[model samples]
Target: MGRYRETYERWKASPEAFWAEAAREIDWSKPWDRVLTLEGDLSRWFEGATCNTCWNALDRHVEGGRGEQLALIHDSAMTGKVKRFTYRELRDKVATFAGVLQRHGIGKGDRVILYMPMVPQAVVAMLACARLGAIHSVVFGGFAAKELATRIDDARPKLIVSASCGLEPGRAIAYKPLLDQAIELSEHKPEACIIVQRAELEAPLVPGRDFDWKDEMEKARAAGAAPACVPVAATDPLYVLYTSGTTGKPKGVVRDNGGHMVALKWSMKNVYGVDPGDVFWAASDVGWVVGHSYIVYGPLLHGCTTILFEGKPVGTPDAGTYWRVIADHGVKALFTAPTAFRAIKKEDPAAELVKKYDLSKFELLFLAGERGDPDTIQWAERALGVPVIDHWWQTESGWPMVANPMGLERLPVKYGSPTVAMPGYEIQVVDEAAKPVPANTTGAIVVKLPLPPGCLPTLWHNDEGFRNSYLADYPGYYKTADAGYLDEDGYLYVMSRTDDIINVAGHRLSTGGMEEVLAGHPDVAECAVIGVADALKGQVPVGFLVVNKGVNRPAEEIAKEAVALVRDKIGPVAAFKTALVVQRLPKTRSGKILRGTMRKIADGEAWSMPATIDDPVILEEIGEALSDAGYGRKG
Candidate 1:
């Protein structure tokens, strides 16, 4: 704790100097002339520095005699296969892939789209793009053709990398057809598409435009040609990842090279308490920012073995798989989404699988991607005998903005709080007027400019959109759009997204807070709380709950227990009386609850279906439940 406060104060006093010192840990091609330069909202970090992200992540480690050391441990429960790659092996593959891309005239500064699953080839493809100094725009593999087409039009990529199929728990879903459809629908088409024959589905190649991945790799290897790492400027674009927007369009978040390298390396050591050669696992897809920073770049940059897991928490042969993997690999740290634990808790409440494995090797477990509820945190920490940190960040901020800073010092655990801001990040709770609020008072969360390294510099192709969406919301601060508060101890409690906050009888209430309470109910498996229009109170919370399997209690009785628990825990201000038991809550393919879509259904507003949704039928079921409960809109 003392170390945390000390580092925070030191960073606040001299951020540029602090970051400069941290940057020294990595192998830079050329030293920076200026540590930082700022003009209004725009920032330039490590000015005059030139380096290749691939060189830092791979070549440096291999050149430093760690070539035989394990760099990637790919475990695919979906395919029931495991593969390992050493630093040297991964480098050779990336070099060959880069050569393949170069043969097609794709070079530095060109954009390439990666639409693939959580496979080793996806990792190879991303590293290959970085090796050539090309910017990779990774669209989530589960995205539909229309959504993929939208991103294709925006990026206009020169090349596309995809897989023939993505294996789910019970079925193998073909992806090459989807990619073909997306290419057909988009106005801009790539020069060529490279497809990995994963499931052996017959995917016809369009002459002169489609190429088989294995054939190209073999040819490149036979030719004895390997692409050299192309040096890129510090401020050059490394990747552009899009975020889901309510306006039916996505905002491409751009991350620069140098700052991203430095910040992520620092975070891997200081925030996650991981060192070189350790096994670190972040159970996220390659498309997300967490995957970009931790699973791929950060750990590799720090010379650690990163795991690429392709499995769910409960489905891939029960809840014991994670424990088995940790035990088998001696994984030092595990980072995953809180929703995963919630689902695991529902499937195996006692966590019997935890005792089956020798998890003594695990040092820490991290939770993110959604709000970490108290029940989920306590369950994981107590079961795993490790610190379960509830860190907070978003797509725009590549690394965590608020975390426990485990490498610095382990502090007293606050169940729901994500703890203090990391070095270079100054967070504050402010009211609608953009003025600072008192401690323990909920308000919009904002970070004082300029943001730390690893944060998005701007939205791709839309500078004004970046300013209007994030910067202009509150002058002088980067509006987080999420609502939270700081305690007297400086621990931050992120309650909900500002739009998800409910106003009941003129008092603001956090639906996430209410959902946390509902989660503690004995008969509840999972639940989502959403604010629906109330003619009198402006808005009120309506809960959609999934009752725990094998619970003997009636659905109505379980709902009553949930309401009582919330009423007692949150007091009368919560106004959380109504709840309905549903079979399943609408969720994205990544398992995020679709609260916004639920709110639209409750309010009877015109809604566009999100391509990321797992099941469209769940929305209809919710509507039926709402109508039966008399909260449905009049048709």
Candidate 2:
């Protein structure tokens, strides 16, 4: 048997012992009373322990004689600037920042909201919060004021850290206006705001409430202020990440201190196969969970050099920017969303830009945050000539639930699957009645409770909401809300969200399956399939395709071919007939296709503009395309 199966079986035998062994990698101020404990349905790992995440991530490395080693590399393609910080440098910065926050009466358990762009200060602020045992919630930079206000009210931060402006390809988005608006709109007003004034755009600060970030840091440094790391209990709240709830109010997924550090540090070597000192880059924004885990904590805790990239896959100059960053930094592994690769593939179909840089040191490419379509995965594999592993997890999980553990074993690649379940997750596919389904049969995917370490203990301030959201659906399992199945060999194929499964005349079909077929089309760059209301078949699948940049063939012809491909591959049971060629698909800032919104548009149902949409104009374009295809509202 492979090492993966052996390790998984061992973990299954005794989860507490497995986690205890993993805990050894972390530095703790006080040992735990127990490895695991259960209170009703909620499980807590490493209870009664005390540890400071900032100490392990920064100070530990510095004290271990790796002070000169590079800790963070902030590379911004938009600004054409690069900043590097050694372990010692970063540690000192974090310590001083912690002192700054301390001076502002921020301490353990106090909440701080970070509303900054992909800047080095954002990283420092997060570590600073951890150093003081404070809980930090990072709202995505440049979010709509109303959405930011909602989070501000929910998290109720004592202090807010923000940048003056966030840069796009050719423009600068002034965040001060939005931050000011959110604060004005919020009922729970924060005491202070620290605004990072960027060179691109310097925002006017409020007279009393807003303080200049640079001035505060300088004052703290001049005073030789450095705060010592504060020890907190294992189960103390580390961070609260908000994921959109069905009820419109966002759910704050709470991650704990000890378990989070242990799981993420373990994942660095075990999941990505990267050693200490190796440069690892997660091309994601810190506003998202991937950023919170990999870009900041994971790499730092593992003593790997992490990159903070502030650019797009295609427009940050060119599609060659990613290759350039890898070649220049000698990045050993890169973890990014599949949508990024799709964007790159769309612009550079032949992967010609890849040849411009030397990526010999780049060994592994991990894709998450979206279903990694087989076509995109295959294209990435061919382009990068490295293992393109697509892992599966969620904002609540904080770490990967299912992945190909490259460090433990290099398992055989499966095109659509994210390989097998990790040691901690006992994934099972079950039908609506909660009965286990046969292998390869599509159903709701769930994890047998209690969930392992690093996953959300509960939603912040809402234990009942947590139970209702995840646990109530499955009696003894954590409802993943994802629909997929495991193969006979135990490899998981995460096809789509549970709601994405469409029913056609009593037959349930996966829209992700249809999307996979459409993506496989030779000229298609990216695609999305959503089920629209149809009187004839209950619900029929409609596809939207974004063809490759250079493909000049008639859009109608290509759309017809895509429809045929889906009909042939998924069989006529899909009822997949219509495919519209569009310039782009509407996506959130995090690159998730807004299928629900598109479905609403096609069904002629009243739908509000999504707050997280990357561009509002894209939805208008999509609506027009649907109308031309005889789908959307006649008006």
Candidate 3:
């Protein structure tokens, strides 16, 4: 048997022993009395242990003689700036910043919200918070004031760290006004604010309430006030990441320090197949879970050089920017959302710009955040001549639940599937009644509880809410909210979110399955399949196709081909007769298609604007397209 199977079986047989061994990789100030403990439906790993996440990420590495090694590389295509920090340099900066926070009365268990751009200061601030054993919440930079206000009220942070401005391709977005507005709107006001003044646009700061980031750091340095790491309990909350909830309120998913460090550190070597000192880059913002796990903590905890990229996949200069970064940095692995590659594919269909850079050092490419259509994965595989692996996880999981374990063994690539469950996750496909479904039968995907190390233990300050949102769905499992089937070989196929399963004349169909067929079209660069209201069939699928940049065929012709493809692949039961060719699909800043909002628009229901929308104008374009196709509210 291969190592992956053996390791999985060992974990299955003795989960406690398996995790106890993994826990040893992390440096603990106090040893755990028990490796695993369960209370009601909640599971806590490494209970009774004490550790500091920042120490494991930075100080330990510095002390271990990797001090001069490159720890972080911040490359900003928006500002045309590049900055590097070694392990020692990063640790010193984080310690000094920790001192600054300490002076502001921030201590263990205190909450600090970081709303900054993809700059090194943002990373330093996060590590500094961890160094002081404080819980940090990072909201996406430039978030709407109302949304930011909601987060502020929920987290009740003592202080906020923000930047003056955030850079885009052609312009700079002033973040200070938004932060000020959020503070004005929130019921619970923070005591102080620290603003980073970027050269692109310096924001006006309020005296006595706001402090300059540079000034505080300089003061801390002048006083030689570098604080040592503060150890906290293993179950102490490390960070609270807020994900959109069904109740229209955000759910703050809480991650603990010890389990987070162990699982992520192990994943860097065993899952990503990257050794210490290798350059790793996750092209995502720190506000998201991927950024929290991989960009800041995971790579650093594993002693690897992590890259912080502040640019789009295609727009910063051209489609060649990703390749250029990878070739220049000798990045061994690149993890990003599939939407990024689709954007690049739309602009450069033939990937001719790939020839301009040397990507021989780029070993693997990982895609997540949504279902990676087989067509896109295959295209990336052929274009890059590397393994384009699709992994599946969520903001709550904090790490990959289903993935191809490249380090243990290179499993055969399976299109439309993330491959198999990881060591800690026991994935199962079950029906609404919580009974296991037959293999290859579509059902809800869930993980058998207690969830492995690194997964969210509870919602911040809302234990009942956590139980209702996750545990109540399936009594003995953690509801993934995703729909898919397990193959005969045990490979997990994450078809789509459970809500995307549309019922057409009593037959449930996965929109993702139809989307896969549509994405396979030669001219289709990107696509989204949403189920719209249908009086006759209850619900029907609608395909929105964005063709390649050079495609000159009539939109109607391409639409007809897409309809035919879905009909051929999924049959008439799909009720997918209508397809529209649109310029682009509306997506969030993190590249998630706003399907729920789109559905509301198509059905002509009362729907408010999404706060995280990348471009609100795209929704207007979509409504017009729907109206043109004799759907939605008609004049």
Q: Where does candidate 3 have its weakest 10-residue lDDT segment? A: 241-250
Error of 3 at 332 (Å): 0.5
Give the Å shift of residue 514 in candidate 1: 1.1
TM-score of each: 0.98, 0.99, 0.99
Model 3, 244-281: lDDT tens per residue? 52234679999999999999998998899999999999
lDDT measured at residue 87 in model 1 versus the true structure, 0 to 100: 99
TM-score of 1: 0.98
Q: Write the per-residue lDDT of candidate 1 for residues 103-135, one digit (tens) a residue.
A: 888899999999998999999999999999999
RMSD of each: 1.3, 0.9, 1.0
Q: Write the per-residue lDDT of candidate 2 for residues 146-171, one digit (tens) a residue.
A: 99999999999999999999999999
Candidate 3 stretches with Cα past 4 Å from truth are 245-248
How far residue 571's Cα lies from its native spot in candidate 1, in Å, is 2.4
Where is model 2 poorest over a 10-residue stretch in terms of lDDT? 241-250
Error of 2 at 512 (Å): 0.8
